[model samples]
Target: MSTPGRGLHGRVLDTLGPAITAGEYPAGSVLRTDELAQRFEVSRSVMREAVRVLESMHLVESRRRVGVTVLAECEWNVYDPQVIRWRLAGSERPRQLRSLTVLRSAVEPVAAGLAARLATPEQCAELTECALGMVANSRGHRLEEYLFHDVAFHRVVLTASGNEMFARLGGVVAEVLAGRTHHDVMFEDPDPAAVTLHVQVAEAVRARDAERAERLTREITEGALQELDILAP
Candidate 1:
């Protein structure tokens, strides 16, 4: 739950958010701000700020008379990057990764098709550059670098789609890709065929081959799902 670059309030969120998503505080559970502050050894103000952040994510609702009530998972903004990160950090990570991959399967192929049709020359260049980066880092235990390009590749595809809704999923896609790399589930080297597929998708998009782009992107996401199934802990 603890990563760098977080302030005091963010630290509280780092701990508390993962706990909530992990069901340590189940749905309908009421949490007192003051008690939580005391338990975390933080001031009430910090706790309040943390609670406010969670409220925005619909993970909890603050009631004046009552307390912060944990909402059901159905009500959560699962696409929120922070929420996605917290979920990936928790015990439910395998399921979380699978669910996110399924989401990509649903959205990214269409996005890829649109990118093929609408991508600007600059965006197409970016896609090719990202693909080359992935190829460069796919082996020799260069996972972190490969992950960077992988996340960027998907983000470029989404943004080039000319759809704001799909574009906003950049962060969601980022968290999922980072989760797979950081968590122990991935292979030492990324799957070779998967890397090749990314390159092909990039080429298809650059060529303005909408149908091929969509099909290749579908293959990428399908491989991700299969990866989760094969690598599930």
Candidate 2:
């Protein structure tokens, strides 16, 4: 069940965030609260809350003299899940995929190395279990379940790294995985090699083999990027 704030706020954010990212609401355009309230047929408070969320994302700013002004794309919080989802839904989705894939390739490999050195035994067990769960879900055609664990798998790796900055990337990993799955970038059946690689990476981390962990992680991420290229329409 969704909270009222999430239900309404997310709807408004989804509507406007994508519009902003897609260039429907270009920079310098002012968004009036009264107009938005009327347009969405919601209460002023709900409209204000929606705008406040967008402002926090750095996609817009409410000024004293002026209304809420859309900022340039560069000003937007690229790491925000909502912003990433909006970008993935836009015409420039391919570009977003490429950039995010590169970022994952760069960051996750290093994260895996750190996780191997710093992860607790419990974290390693969780990662191994998550990877194994992926195989079961994939075999059963439980795609949503598979994706949930897949996201969990990466999130665990990020969090296990013990570096606060690396831990922050868990959401980014979730965004890419969810966005890709939602867009049908992932097929119904999981790749056996990918699953195998995931298990290998987990085992490497468990064994404290940092070199192997990093190498296997790089392989997994690189494979994903290749798949994205193949799936690009």
lDDT of every predicted structure (CA atoms): 0.90, 0.86
- At residue 181, candidate 2 shows an lDDT of 75
> Model 1 lDDT vs. the true structure?
0.90
In candidate 1, what residue range of length 10 has the lowest lDDT sum?
Answer: 1-10
Candidate 2, lDDT over the whole model: 0.86
What's the C-alpha lDDT at position 106 in model 1? 91
List ranges where model 2 is wrong by over 4 Å: 1-14, 41-49, 89-92, 137-142, 230-233
Which 10-residue span in candidate 2 carries the lowest summed lDDT?
1-10
Give Cα distance to truth, residue 211, candidate 2, Å.
1.2
